[model samples]
Target chain A: MLSLSSQFPILVAIAPLMTAPICALFRGKAAPWAITTIASAFAFYISLQLLLTVASSGPISYELGGWAPPWGIEYVVDLLSGFMLVLISGVSTGVLLFARESITKEVPTSQLGLFFAAYLLALTGMLGICITGDAFNVFVFLEIMSLSSYALIAMGERTDRRALTAAFQYLIIGTVGATFYLIGVGLIYMMTGTLNIADIAARFPEIEGTRPILAAVGFIVIGLAIKLALFPFHVWLPNGYTYAPSIITAFFAGTATKVSVYLLIRYIFTVFGVDYSFEGLELTDILLPLAVLGFLSMSAVAIYQSNLKRLLAYSSVAQIGYIILGLALANETGLTASIVHIFNHAIVKTGLFLSVGCMFFVVGSTYLKDLEGIGRRMPITTFGFVLGGLGLIGVPLTPGFISKWYLVVAALEKGSVIGYGIVALLMISSLLAVIYIWRVVEVAYFREMPEGTVKEEAPISLLVPTWLFILGSFYFGIETSFNVGIAKAAAAFLMGGA
Target chain B: MSFGFFNYWVFIILLMIGLYTVMSRSNLVKKMIGLSLFQISVFLFYISMGKVSGGTAPIVVDGPLDTAAPIYSNPLPHVLILTAIVVGIATTALGLSLVVRIRESFGTIDEEEILEMKDGA
Candidate 1:
């Protein structure tokens, strides 16, 4: 039975990889959708098995191609990785369904199979990146994900020239980030003589005071910061999200950056060790304030955007701030808050973006002015968006609220007035979120309708998946047992393996 | 710090050239060249690290005559760098393809000019 967990990782990864090629066989719209749905479901089931196995036993280690760790490639599935696998694959299954109808409207029929192929390839990369324990293997999987993302975004060129440029811009930044990461990894290898991440951690402490290791940490963090779009490095996200086709925007918003954040956490906590990460340097002092500024400033910018998709893009950056702030706290509670929010944010953002896809279906424009009185016409979608918006604001009875509560508790545990002040500042940021959501709601509900423009709600196909996430936000909000339990365990591991 | 330090200096010079092209140059192709150089800098870093004071390639030979105590350079970093180099090539190719499309669609590979046109639109 324990051996079942080892195969879980490969099954989850290879299922989608195999599906990607077979998806090319089907031509018609229905057939491709059917294949994607089935593949995603299978992948999600494999993730579920992996998660349960990890929960019952402990971290599952599988050496690929019958190779041993430290000398050969390994896939390590602990609580954190298994937890992330579930979130990614679960949301992927839902999104692939939602994308079926949404994509048909956006992309041409001839490109449908190709889009599904790219989708599965992206899923495979994210899953592999989460499970793989080898440091170099992370880079390999990152490229696979990035390459597929570029293709997915570039496929949106038929909709707007802006997507072409956006994809190009992301291509540039992403390439630089990946290159910087490779350099950092190379530097670490130079010092440690190992590519297995756990082996690196075991060896890192002996050379902790060395300059090369320090430099490697610096290079790696900055590179990952760019990939995760932390504050100063987030120039590529808004346009990338806004200009891509609606379905692609929804998928990437929900999955891509979150996967990158998982890698960042894995490196900082698992590979570097928390003491070296937090106390060995002034990294917390440097990172904490930047995170605070990102939360406030990006949320402020998010409020003023007229384009709905772009507004959500900025909000996504602001949300990233919260996660980093949790990391900066460098305590068990703080780590718990960060891990919990990773799941909550994935749910909230997927709901928001899918609702926007709904709007795109009806009105064909995400401009705030164009959506006047749209809520009355498309009540279901608009209501889902509003619930998602409330979740984003950390309103009570939302998953976000549960995470925010934990964050404030974590902050207060620091025993500083400044810590409480950070909570107040977070509260203030949520107020700003309310303002932006209100602006959209006011325009959609209270304002006069455009003459002779009768736009209805999105189809049932889109509505079901969108509501799944929207309801998931509330469901997880009330039922905190799973999130809280897993998060506490994951956090303990992050604080150097309890 | 003698002749070994001299090669390090050349590597740094190439590294800075690559960094400058990525930062200061506006043309996309030039940026790709810069990226390639930047990548090669890391390759240089790995190769230099693998070098032992007096070592040959780490190849094991089996025979009675293989009695000489052979010191060998570290081979793991060299192998990792080979994989990284291939990744770098893929990135360069993909980046250049995007550049081609950008030129075709936007009519400019110059970053500033592209931004200028976008602003005008």
Candidate 2:
């Protein structure tokens, strides 16, 4: 028998990918979804086991197709990638559980199998990107991820025609970002003659200041920032999220950008060391201002949006700014804070978007006016949204509070007035969260049930997953050992220069 | 840095033209073609990077482990570009398919007109 530990890394990616075609071949309503659930569940289970293996054995490096590293592709599952694999697969399984009903409503039945297959493809792309240790392989998987996402977003046309425009705009922007990244990787490969990430990091110090290396860093960061929707490059995100099917929006909101952030972290700290990528270039100086502007301005933009999903999309951008803020600190504490927020934000955003999806299912619209008195009808979902909203607002004993505490602590550790100023910014951004979230709360709770609406809740299938995610946020909020331990080790490994 | 970098100069010019077309053109099909052009230039850059001035092919024609080191082109860049080429084609196919669907819905493929309809809604 093949040992699970040895095959764990590749299996995590291959399981879902191999199953996707099988799903596409299925014709029935339940078969495709059943296969998706089983495939993703298996991937998630393997990811959990792989994370355990890493925690015990340090890191697992597997040579693919029996070829060794620096010459052939390798799959390296360190603490960080292991952490991300678990989160990505875990959220995928969660979103798949909630996807059945929403997907049926939003996508045409003839294309149902193909749609789930595309979701599995997107999942495979993300997991493969996290697991692979080669830089060029990352680009290949990035395109796979981008292409499938464009397909999935376009499938939203049955519900709304704007889905086509959204997918088109997203394709244009996403292709540019990927092309920029290709240029960066081509430059690096030209200079280094290798594609393995660890091998590149080992060689980065020797040719630290070359013009090509500088340009490579610039190109790679800008490209990834575009993908991650950071600051001015975020034009493609709101429409993409708002117009896509709710399941697609939630999954992307929860996992996609976080993976991009993880990729940014990996490239910055691993492929190019901090001494070269951060200090040699004074990256913190550039990132600090952009991050601040992103969170503050986006949060303010979020408050006036009438569409609930679009509002949440803006807030997601601002929250991403918080993750980058932790990176801009360029210290272990800050890095720890950033990684921890990855977990926290994934849980909270998935829950929030899933809850909104439930609202969309029941009321047939996600507009604010349409939600006037949904709270009284869908009490469970409203309560779940309230929990997720409190997490967003950083209520004590919520996971959001923990991330904010670490961010503030990291800033105070800087021991400068600028750090103090950032703390104030974090506080003000959370207040903005309060205004937006409360607008929904007030509209849901205080207003009379819109004239003639029925009394009902989302199906138990959707409710189960939404509640699990909401409960997960509170569970992690109340307990820190499991998450903080992994985050700190990953942060320390990164701080020691990958 | 020298006259030997002629292919690279051509690659850069083609890339700029492609990017300019992508940015300036409103027609959806035209934009996908611009993306293909941009990606094709990248393919050229990779192919050119693999060249060795006097080298013929990367095939081991002198038998494995011959005494004389053969002047063969680097095979790795060729392999990398092949994969990238496949990706570029997949992107083009998907982009065109999306454009087809987009034209079906919007009645036109112009980005500005699509947005005007969106706003009018």
Candidate 3:
């Protein structure tokens, strides 16, 4: 019998791939849903097994089709990637379970099977990108995810024409970004004669200052920045998030950009060793200031949006700033802070958006006005939203607090008083978050109930997933050893140690 | 730097023309063509980098282990470029598809007009 550890990665991708065509072939609602759920369930189970294996052993590297690395493709599973795999697959399963009812309600009935197929394809692409060890493979999986996302976003046809426009704009930007990245990889290959990431890292130091390599760095960083929606490139994100079908919003908001951030970390730390003079070239001078600007400006902008979904979209950009700021510090503590925040912020954002999705399901709109007097009617969901909002604000018991504390500490460790400035800025931003959350709160609880308001909590289907994510934020907050310990190790690895 | 340099300089000019059209022009079809041209410039750059004057095909007709003779430019870059060209074609196709969708939805193919209509709405 094959041990679970060896087969886990292939199983994670193949389950979804095989079921995708099966889902398309089926005719009935129940059968397709069952097949999709089973596939996701199997993938989630394999991911958990893989996580346990990685936690026990160190990184697991497997050669595909029995070919060794530097020539054949490889799959490298380290603690950082295992962390991400569990998150993506686990959240994907939750979203698929939730999508059964959500898709039927929002998408047209005729396209239900097609929607499932696209969802599986997107999940497979994300997993493929996460597990692969080759650069060109990364490009292929990036296209897979992008193409499926465009289809999924365009499916939101009746509610708004803006979805089509958003999808189109994303397509253009995404193609350009991917092409830029391919050019970077090609340049690197021409220099190194190998496309394996480990080989590239081993060779990056010898040809450090060549014009071609610097240009490669520039191209790759810009391409990834666009995908990650770093502040200046984030305009496509707000409309895309706000207008896409509800389940798609929750999934992409939670996982898509997070995966790109993973790639960014991997490329920066693993493919290109961290301690080169290139650090000064990329991080301290340029990315630091942009990250700071992203944090402040996006938060200020998020405060004034009337639409709740748009408001949250801008907040996502601001949160990305926090992650990037941690990375820009270019130290072990700073890198750990960034990685820790990736997981913590993912939990927070997932809870926040899932709560919003619940609100959307009940009220049929996510305008702040629509939430007025909803507190009494939907007390549990309102309370959950309140908890997630406080987490976003970095309250002491919440996961966001841990990430923010580390980021501030990292900045201080770098001998910079600007650490204090960033801490204060973060607090003030939280206060702004409070203002918006309070706007929803006051409208929900303090204001008079609108006439003809119906008394319905969000369906248990939605509430269960939303609460699970909120509880995870708080749980991970209290049990800080796992996140902090692994983050430090991964950060060390990024800083060019074991 | 000689006539060879002039060929490279022309390639750079073509690249800039393509990028300028992509970023500055308002027509959707023109932008697609620009994207294609920009990609073609990169192809030219790779091909130029791999050129070995008076070089024949590097494939060994005798056997796999003719290790002593170096007769040609590297075939690896050419192989890499082939994959890149295929990816480029896919990108162009997808861009055109999106442009078609945009035109159908907005009833216009001009970027400025589309923006104006969006803002007006």
- For A1-498, candidate 1 gives per-residue lDDT tens digits of 556645777888888889998897778788787888898899889888888989998988988887898899999899999999999888888888788778887788987887888888888999999999998999888988888888788887776777777887787788778877887887788788889999998898898769888888888898888898998899889988988888778878878988888988888887788888888876788778888999999999998999999999999999999999998888889989999999999889988999998898888888998899989889999999999999999999998898889899989987688798899999998998999899889998999889997757789998999999899889999898887789899998778571
Candidate 2 segments whose C-alpha is farther than 4 A from its true place: B63-67, B118-121
DockQ of 3: 0.37
Residues A4-34 of candidate 3 have per-residue lDDT tens digits of: 6677777787789778887887765667777
Worst 10 residues of 1 chain A by lDDT: A1-10
Candidate 3 CAPRI level: acceptable
Compare candidates 1 and 3 on DockQ and give the better one. 1
Instruction: Estimate the lDDT of model 1.
Output: 0.86
* Docking quality level of the chain pair in candidate 2: medium
What's the candidate order when arranged by decreasing TM-score? 2, 1, 3
Candidate 3 wrong stretches, greater than 4 Å: A1-4, A277-282, B2-15, B43-54, B63-73, B78-86, B117-121
In the range B40-81, model 1's lDDT, one tens digit per residue, is 887787788889979998988676885876899998878888
Model 3, residue B120: distance off in Å is 7.3
Clashing pairs in 1: none
Clashing pairs in 2: none
What TM-score does chain B get in every candidate? 0.87, 0.89, 0.85
What lDDT tens digits, residue by residue, belong to model 2 across residues A45-69? 9999999999998989999998989
lDDT of 1 at A314: 96
